[model samples]
Target: MSHPDPWRTATLGNGYAASVCVTPDGDTVLWLLAHGGCIEVDDDYGCCCTDCAPHEQLNRPIPHTMRSALDRPIQPRCSRPRSDGQPCRTPVARDGLACHWHRTTKETAR
Candidate 1:
């Protein structure tokens, strides 16, 4: 199953929202403005600016990071049924459909 994206656009106290995330190394921060702008900054003044692009033309990758924050998937709820026959309210395993208990039982039976 596919999971939601960890990085999300947040409203900056106004009608505007932007996707923000930090690099895995925690040295750089990147954000894409919903108003056709992009911002990137590092510790020093090496990279810092708010570049305004045309509508839907903000296609640029964050630099100096091993993995893109957008590539990481968000946590997903389990699809199993609970004791009351309701959907499970817990998150699923990282690489499996069910949660730890459900997946473990099914795997052990095999």
Candidate 2:
């Protein structure tokens, strides 16, 4: 089997790591190190949209040191089954202090 890359590779440690799931509308939910975890922004203006389109965007990725995987809010899209078929809480806290998973973007004016 092949190994999955944990990092999203937006800008090294300063960019969105994962491009979770995109809304039918346009909002992008990217995994960042800052903003605590998840970061919501214009779909056409974030680096976490590599899986989106190869268009020039605005926001990039913040510095890893300045990024945080906490204080964001996230919602669970699906659930998983355990060995006994028990469902466990797969918290995808995007912007809450509880879960440490959020998407981030860098500035384009830079």
Candidate 3:
């Protein structure tokens, strides 16, 4: 079976639209604005923007406004711990919790 796409597109009203996707780091979501810039939102709902105007307007609570688009499941990241002892940020392989490199190491350990 095919996995559901993680990207979502939403209309932001006033003729503006955005394509939203989770960042590879898995800690932030990126909003690619129609106006040729982007915004990055963290789990705490804090945001940074490439354009000041849109940032001023769309900087409010994002979950309420983009509920439908943000409701989809987030892609799972690799579970292996890194040197800093944090979980790896890489996306997991289709059938496993570890990313490619970590998955190989796991298999070799068996």
Candidate number of the best TM-score: 3
Candidate 2 has an lDDT of: 0.37
Model 3 ranges with Cα > 4 A deviation:
1-65, 93-96, 106-110
Report lDDT (Cα) of residue 77, candidate 1.
Answer: 73
Q: Looking at model 1, which ten-residue stretch has the lowest summed lDDT?
A: 46-55
The per-prediction tally of clashing pairs is 0, 27, 0
Each candidate: what lDDT?
A: 0.47, 0.37, 0.51
Query: Candidate 2 on 1-90: residue-level lDDT in tens?
Result: 011134532434554444443445544454333333334444443434333322323566544433444434446522333346554344
How well does candidate 2 score on lDDT at residue 24?
A: 51
Give the per-residue Cα lDDT of candidate 1 at 23: 48
Residue 17 shift from truth in candidate 3, angstroms:
30
Pick by lDDT: 2 or 3, better one = 3
Model 2 RMSD vs true structure = 22.0
Candidates in order, TM-scores: namely 0.25, 0.18, 0.34
lDDT of 1: 0.47
Which residue pairs of candidate 3 clash? none
